[model samples]
Target: MEQLHQQSILFAVGINHKTAPVEIREQIFVHEDEIPALLTELRKTLVEAVVLSTCNRTEIYGVTTRTDLDLDFYKDLLINFKGAETFVSREHFFASVSCAACQQLFQVATSLDSKIVGDTQILGQLRDAYAVAKRHEATGKILNQLHQRAFKIGKQARTETRLHKGAVSISLAAVELAAEIFGSLTGKTVLVIGAGETARMTAECLIQRRVGKILITNRTRSNADELLESLKKSNNFAGETIALNELKNHLNEADIIISSTSSPAPVLEKTDFDRQTNKILLIDIAVPRDIAPEVAECKNVLLKNIDDLHSIVDRNSRRRMADLPLVKRIIMKEMSNFLVWYYSLPLLPTVLQCGAKPDKEIQSEIVRVKEFLLANVSHVHKLAMQNGAENFAGHVEVVNTLVAMKNAALTLRLEIEA
Candidate 1:
């Protein structure tokens, strides 16, 4: 029975905005360059793995054959791998297995489980994570199917629901906060620090608010120039690229400062803003934070970090709650579809064993069984697509037949092996 249970178990483990603060999340944050090595290390224990790390969360989705592996096992692996055992602990991590894992990932990919619900960026991030895993050959059949379906379900959620109807991202939330503070942004000078997607989105939002002047600065001047150029084509805003070294020179001129740089440390310290006498609103959306915590102590300076946006996020999340049921329905349906396919996987080997092929021919028999399983999955998927919600009963009947076949195959293989 233990040998029979050796089929791949889909699982997920990690810390997110819900489980840990930005400081702890950043400590375990996995950069794109770090993913390949991490996947290599995880492959020692997992049959397949995908690492999805963003400013708000760092999650590992994996498949393992070992039944002994549990939530704490992955928690310890993450703590040691990220060298974060010093401050982080198992309590800060959350784990899910099998169907729960699939449900968690589906929610994440659809932005239902984000720090801010309806965040449009998480889907792209999920896609990128899966791409990296696939490119590095880190994914096998289980992860490949799971992630592919996750992407599709993510798209379906967005298209079918109004979850993303309002200000749906951290960048937009930051801009909304700035608008609330300043009342009117018509002539407000905004300084944008960083050339990443968040920074670009902030600048665009500022432009939409008719901000008078925008100063963009980045570590790489050319990237800032590129952003400025892109913004110029879209909006007729007064925007200029400033050198990062000269940031302090114009710091006092801006009414609002939005920083989303990927710096490992604070780019703006207390001393940098101490000399400023004018009122300024600074929003730091980066995990490691581009602005130091002490900067909030400076007179007339209002500093808001990622966590500060929770109130705004909560309000917007409530507004989007009406669409939640539809999105969850989509998730539940897809999860059922995925589990049906997943539960059938173990039967492939069972059917192969029942064949009683010679050792030399076993490998070929395994391939044949794999193709058969894939065909059945494909057929089921086709039926679900063609039938839609109204024919869910019919789909379940098809699923029941597949499950019966799997059981019969398992019984035959078990008897032969016994």
Candidate 2:
């Protein structure tokens, strides 16, 4: 790793699917409403922070005042805030700082860190995380820029390479499992539960397989009808819509069931399919899980949940890893551009100097400004003059120059003189 000239304040820390099992990852997974509260607690210590909680990872992309921000602070925060202390340990915690941290964020936003390596869902997930932080005032100039760069890189990575062109997400993985079980779905009937994005994706996958029929069921019949209209195939396609109240009647009729609803509890139980003697595959892709675990115990009914989809996700991710080098090339380019803008900020040097206290050495001038002044500061006055006037940021140029000059002889003052 190149020795980053900037303060090692940027940090990426948390347990992800790579370090922990799916059980633990889901245990700590944060909901949308919990973001404000989590970020509230995080900003208490971290200078700028974003909590990026996804199905595959729960990570904190943060910037702190001090370079030596204890990694335990993140773990303890999760323990106290999300009750994750018992579910995981230090072994599950992974961390990166400075340039490495930037690289991780870029890669994750670009889906390089995903279970489905090139899955684009992460881009939206990252955006939502940034939006939450921005909403809570948890993010500042540094994190704002970092996340924006990540968004740009994510789009560019997809455009410049085949990263997401053939990417398989969790929903698609469920369809893959279906294909493996039933040699071909050309003549099979698929029952889709829910009118949400996941269910729509599953139906699309089934369509690609040339499924003979599709039955959509939703709490609102109108939603099911809307989904049916979208899934309708031209030239003698068979599709139908029904209310959730009618779900039980169709269970035995479907060869495959893909359920991804927002219900708090299991929508389908073992008793719902007691009469199902023919081999049927039920895939519940919901997070809280739309289908009961006992459904798998029903004779001739094979149940697959969100966790089971990961095996296929892992296999597809490995295949997609072939495109990682190309994706990384894009991330590195973006990282370089971000660093250029970051190091040129004059006040950033002041902030770092204030945060990083001088250690046990000679307490000399070189120790104070050599790394701090030259590395992160350039002539802000020079840039301001080109812009025709001294702007607010440019005003800092004089203050910065005076401080550096003073530090050339004496220790940096603990506080600016009154």
**Candidate 2 segments whose C-alpha is farther than 4 A from its true place:** 1-8, 66-69, 84-86, 219-225, 232-237, 262-264, 306-322, 343-418
lDDT (Cα, tens digit) per residue for candidate 1, span 206-313: 888999999999999999999999999978989999999999999889999999988878889999987897999999999778898899999989999889887788
lDDT of 2 by residue, 1-418 (tens): 1122334256778878689876666667777778788888888778899999866788998876553347676776786676767776767777765555777888898988876777867898789889988988888888999998999989988888887877887778889999988888898999999997777878888888889898999988898898778767443468898779989998878999998876656789878888887889998877556788888888999888766766787777776667778887787667766754553443233434455664455245334544554443334323323431212222233334534554553443554442
**Pairs that collide, model 1:** none
TM-score between model 2 and native: 0.74
Worst 10 residues of 2 by lDDT: 387-396
The whole-model C-alpha lDDT of candidate 1 against the native structure comes to 0.81
What does the lDDT read for residue 362 in candidate 2? 27
After superposing candidate 1 on the true structure, give the runs of residues whose Cα lies further than 4 Å from its correct spot.
1-5, 351-418
Candidates' lDDT values, in order? Answer: 0.81, 0.73
Flag clash pairs in model 2.
Answer: none
